[model samples]
Target: MPDAQLRPEPFIQQTAPAALEDLRARLRATRWPDTPEDAGWSLGTDLDYLRELVTYWAEDFDWPAQEARLARLPRFRVPLGGLGIHFVHARATAPTTPALPLVLSHGWPDSFWRYSKVVPLLTDPGAHGGDPADAFDVVVPDMPGYGYSDRPAGPPLDSVAVAGLWAELMTVLGYERFGAAGGDVGSHVSRYLGLDHPDRVVAVHRTDGGLPVFTGDPADLTQEERSWIDGAAAWGAVEGAYAAIHRTKPQTAAFGLTDSPAGLAAWIVEKLRSWSDSDGDIERSFTKDEILTNITLYWLTGTIGSSMRMYRANAAIPPAQHARRVEVPSGFSLFPGEPVLPPRAWLERTTNMVRLTEPARGGHFAAFEEPEAYAQELRDFFRPYRTGTAAD
Candidate 1:
């Protein structure tokens, strides 16, 4: 779709009762895995916790209720770059007038489910107890193969190419210039949006910053930045095994995840528990039902494998292209619990960072876990660039 014409259509989310029953059946039939009593998440996902979650998911968790709530968002699909792009376009109806447009990108193991909580807060800040002037028209897209979006038959699109697709999507939605924000893979996408389409992207915001963008002598970097780089590498050495698997053998892992709902839950819930600011109590970050709903989206859609394949595609990109820097204004929010928290100096020097904040709480899924902070950070960061009719 070099020059794809936009055809936006309303989307309705429905998981067939048969599918729901099938998921329950799968949960019920899960082949148990044995683990040592004291291992308790040190090796991987705790077998006991996963069993507890599976029990709840099979008998108690309600898919229809969760689906109905998610359906309340105004979702739509528009063809862009030879793919069907699904997104929640819950624009701000603030009476202040021209609410700024914001395009949010989601990362792995999750979809638009990530930013659903932040949508209401950003699109209606006044209703959430913030000034109406801070309102924004929120747009959260399911990256190809992640949510209800179409899966690529060939290779999946990488961050740079996906950034191009997003630029086109925003244009189709009539946003000549807008803000871009994301975390995880989304952080990479938002950076590319600022780097590749600076004229169209007013500013960019990210919760995490990764990708080898720096060049020249490492000795020039400050002690904190150098330590951060080394720390990030060490963290990756321990935490990046999943990434390595995704890059090397997503198809092999996808088989079980695609067939067994318990398999899917075990694979994703571990990350949710480990990456959050919850301090090991998973419920502190997300309710049991909330966790199930996220996994259910992947289960019902059968997208776990496709989503994992994106890492393989991303790895194919040349390091030279991945090293491109941003010319547009960039913002960073260093959430306390994210696995690798890059220092402010590293962030600014890496990208054209303007606003940087160390929020007291939240983690990798900050938008879902702490929507208020996420929304407020976005409002504060993009305020300078939102030049239009102010709220009266």
Candidate 2:
């Protein structure tokens, strides 16, 4: 049977009254922590702040309403190569001359909701004063085992395997060739899309500067590169506690994360604080409700364990994963606040290095944090290959 005719499994929105009850109970039963007079983020999440937030999460937050809002979005589970992948495909209402197809992938600790603000911007660019011809039919898939998607059932799903599934999904939707964009784990998948299926991928763009591969000469490093390295080293010292756990003992880490909502919240929230341009507090950029919504998705789906397992799978790959050079046309918008934004020389080693822009501001969640700038950067990058002229 043709792939398109192969019907996608409908995402049956599951609402467990018991799960909601459990969340309320957990919040009510939270063992309170005492705060130190001088302690701040240097000591991690503030206890007083936690007391207030957990109180709200239990007393004031409306899980049913938020779940209903999410359920309103179009969702599906398509069978691809013996795997059932779930995705949210929100189509643009306004017509585009050619109807450019674009796949926006999200990374770890983020669901399809990461691009919640971004989907409309790209699909309806005219609203943002962008060319109608540049409008896209956006496909935002939850990485397998991350959100509404299924867990890695039979075999371990790595980056390359997921890319193949993505190509299949796009093909099913009649997009012969399309543009791709992503960051974090998604950035790796986007790069693999360009490398593994260059014929179908017109151009690859990533928010993360580049992958962390030791390709450049350490001896010939500029002052900036040295600082970059120093910054990275410092982060590993202070903020990389999660990475170490995810890499070595993911199952152990998952136990605590999966059990306690507060534990999950603190673990993920710490990364958002350290990795984002939030200035100091997570609430400065993301509301407590917004933060918990993402966390709730993980907890409800029981994916905290499976998601961490991805790091272990990546680590098991041979160290020579970057020995091969990529030949696809690529663009990058490097955000300074991301975990490891790469230098131009480093990016050139992995991608064809077509276009590179250092954004004045933004973070790992670029599309959500700065939509206008991110949308403008995307329009500028993909303008060259758009099929229809503005006159058309």
Candidate 3:
């Protein structure tokens, strides 16, 4: 049992009626922007698609239904490391054997919503066509400044700081040792978890090995590794402007994104389309409601700024820290749709990589884009490390 001081309080999703109305009004009154004739997604978010999505957002999208769906998850808030952390904690369902404790961290442009689909599949595998013995007691936390979690009042918390908070959070949740898995920003957090708390983190799983940061001799890298590094640099040049803005001047970008629903949707929807396996059509992977739900969470929470500030905080992380290798057992799943895929040599150089897999589909948001496949990856990677029951 958790200590009284650390006991979690049940969280309910309830947005004021007026807030929802105001969002609709804002969406309906968006000032349209002009683009060159036949301009697709080459420049930025497709204007035609934004207009259509905003129109639906203003008139047809249903928030109450979405709220109800979110409410079905086991949500809670608990104070840890001077911040109120919101997370979903679901216990394994009728495990035929001991269940392992796993923590799923989310990344940028998303929150706990990123892992919503995979939660059930992991916690109740038997019901989802998997063995009950593979069930896991899953915990998905919204990093500070994202979702319902309170933003840091002072300097933005970087990945290492967030990892410490997660360590404490797991302790509060009665998990002394657990599996860690994440992608994007969450991947950074999990890497730190393995690096900083190897004794507690049974294993770490990540989608990518993080942006290649080799301070050693370039000759030390394999040919494949060098090629991957070059590809990542090239990819960053084209698709990394948003990150640059987030790192250098989040406040300037935040004003418009926080103020305009259409702008926020454009900012996030573009990534959802380009980063996922949708093949230029985002709707193929996520419904409008799904897209809106994620963006709306950012809008309602008014967290776009604080969330972006994390980039600035992370930028200050010393190169020495980046050069430090994670010794804990780790696994990588390179989803085909992800733009930058780290090679096996790069991963092995940086981590004690026990497994490396290239899944047939999915992208940056694999958990949300391919929940069953994502869940299966976790189950397979962590199976060997599941030494005891959830209670252990």
Return the TM-score for candidate 2, rounded to 2 decimals. 0.91
What lDDT score goes with residue 137 in model 1?
82
Clashing pairs in 2: none
Candidate 1 residue-wise lDDT, 1-392, digit = tens: 22345678999988778988888887898899888879999998999899999999989998899999999999999888788999999878653757888999999889999998888889888898887887898889999999999999898889888999898888777787888999999998998899888888888999998743456688889899888888878888888888999999999999988988888998999999999999999999999999998999999889999999999988898877755677798889989998888877777677787888999999999999999998999988988888742222
Residue 362's lDDT within candidate 2 is 78
How well is each residue in 120-213 modelled by candidate 2, as lDDT tens digits? Answer: 7787888877877667778888888788787887545777777878988888766777888898888878888888888878888899854355
| Residue 361 miss distance in model 1 (angstroms) | 0.7
Off by over 4 Å in 3: 1-3
Pairs clashing within candidate 3:
none
Model 1 vs truth, CA RMSD = 2.4
Residue-by-residue lDDT tens digits, candidate 3, 12-41? 989999999999999888999899999989
Candidate with better TM-score, 1 vs 2: 1
| lDDT over C-alpha atoms for residue 211 of model 1 | 40
